[model samples]
Target chain A: DQQVKQNSPSLSVQEGRISILNCDYTNSMFDYFLWYKKYPAEGPTFLISISSIKDKNEDGRFTVFLNKSAKHLSLHIVPSQPGDSAVYFCAASDFINTGTASKLTFGTGTRLQVTL
Target chain B: DAGITQSPRHKVTETGTPVTLRCHQTENHRYMYWYRQDPGHGLRLLPYSYGVKDTDKGEVSDGYSVSRSKTEDFLLTLESATSSQTSVYFCAISDDRELLGDEQFFGPGTRLTVL
Candidate 1:
């Protein structure tokens, strides 16, 4: 069963525009959500995250909004740049301890392409 | 990233051969995990380790075995290679601070091809 889902496989947007990527989850037990960006042949890099307690978190040009009732979360990058072109994955975890087998469930990933 | 390293960055092996991938971390974090990435499957966890000699299976652990002899090293072994096992594998490390909500840092990943 896919607990986390990123229905969009790919997205294209022009530079200076806002790029929005969406994710949905089935399990309400997940208290932590994260976004990671990956380039070709490279490991994923942590981008942004939101706790279950909050509805939105922002850092610089990136923002994450979570809606607990909808079981959905989204990442928005304002004034998207070409460097923002990469695959974005949404992950959810249930635990806070590292030694407790806290496994992260990832979405299928959405590839965002930004053109000038 | 988190001083995590995955050795044998690229490999090509034939079916039925035994293969092992190594993940080493200098961060000394308590948690380590192995994941495989595919086209439509995203990243699937194969195994994870909490401490030395303490390990557990993830969502997909079939045809694979893992060992954590020390805090710094985690090894994943494919008992018998198969074409379906050809995918990029990633190792990640994270601390125990759950309340502060730290994120997992990933290694560069190793690409394996089973012919």
Candidate 2:
């Protein structure tokens, strides 16, 4: 069973345009969410994240909006750059500190293309 | 760009062969994880180690095992390779604050092709 889902396989947008990537989850226990950017032949790097308590979080040019009521979240990149062309993965975790098995559940991923 | 390294970045092996992938870290983090990335299955945790010799099975632990003798090294071994096991393997590391909302750093990944 896929606990997390990224419906869009790929997306393309022009430079300086806003890019929105969507993701969904079925589990309600997930308390923290994260997005990672991966490049070819390289490991995924941390992008941004949001907590269940908050509905939105923003970084320099990236923003993550979480809708706990709908079990959905979206990543928005303002003025998308060519360097943003890569695969973005959405991950959810229960975020516990009990020392039990704590792991992040990831979505399939969405490939974003920033065209000039 | 965390201090994580995965050895044998690319390998081709046959069925029934035993293969071991190594992950080395320099950050001295307490948490280490092994994950496989496939087409449909985004990334599934194989097994993880919290400390030296302390390990636990992840969601998908069949046909695979892991060992962490030191804080810097974590090894994933396939007892008997299968065509189904062919995928890109990633090793991630995080500190004790992982559960407190810290992100994990991933390795470059190892592509294993089992025929």
Candidate 3:
């Protein structure tokens, strides 16, 4: 069974508009959530993160919103630019459950395209 | 940015052959991990090491083995390759001294194809 899921496989948005990506998790033990962006032939780079204690976290034009009650989270990018186009992955960790290490569970991923 | 490199970035081998991939890191992080990325599976953990000489299996450890003899290196081996095992493999490192947010730095990747 997939613990984390990204329902949408792809998303397209016009440049200068807002882009939204959603993710859902089945395990309630997850306490920390993170987002990573990947370009072709490259490793993923950290974009933003949010703790379960808080409902939202923002950095520049990227904002991450968490709804613990719904076990869902969304990433919002305002004024999306063509450079923002890439694959986005959502990951969650449960430090308490994985006693020794904070092992992560990643969602499939969503491909984002910012059209000109 | 994490000073990590994966060897044999691209390889092709026939079934039943043995293959090993290397991961070297300069960060000297205490934790190293092996993951495989498939089209529909996202990224699945194969094995991980918390320290030199200490390794453990992950969600998808079958048909694979791992070794961590030194602090800066980790190895993943496939005893007998199979077509089903063809995928992009990634290596990641983490430092326990940092926060417990589970942030991991990844290497480029190694694409292996089993014919």
- Residues A1-116 of candidate 1: C-alpha lDDT, one tens digit per residue: 99999999999999999999999999999988999999998999999999899999999999999999999999999989999999999999886244543568999999999999
Specify the CAPRI tier of model 3. Answer: medium
**Between 1 and 3, whose DockQ is larger?**
1
Q: Specify the poorest-scoring 10-residue window by lDDT in model 2 chain B.
A: B94-103
What is the alpha-carbon lDDT of model 1 when measured against the actual structure?
A: 0.92
Give candidate 3's chain B TM-score: 0.96
The models' CA-based lDDT, in order, is 0.92, 0.92, 0.91
Error of 1 at B44 (Å): 0.4
Among these predictions, the greatest DockQ belongs to 1
Q: Give the TM-score of candidate 2.
A: 0.96
Off by over 4 Å in 3: A96-100, B97-100
lDDT of candidate 3 over A15-97, digit per residue (tens):
99999999999999988899999888888888999988999999999999999999999999998999999999999987523
lDDT of 3 at B100: 38
Taking the candidates in order, what DockQ does each have? 0.67, 0.63, 0.59
**Chain A TM-score by candidate, in order:** 0.95, 0.95, 0.95
Ranking by lDDT: 1, 2, 3
- Return the TM-score for each candidate structure: 0.97, 0.96, 0.97
* DockQ winner, 1 or 2: 1
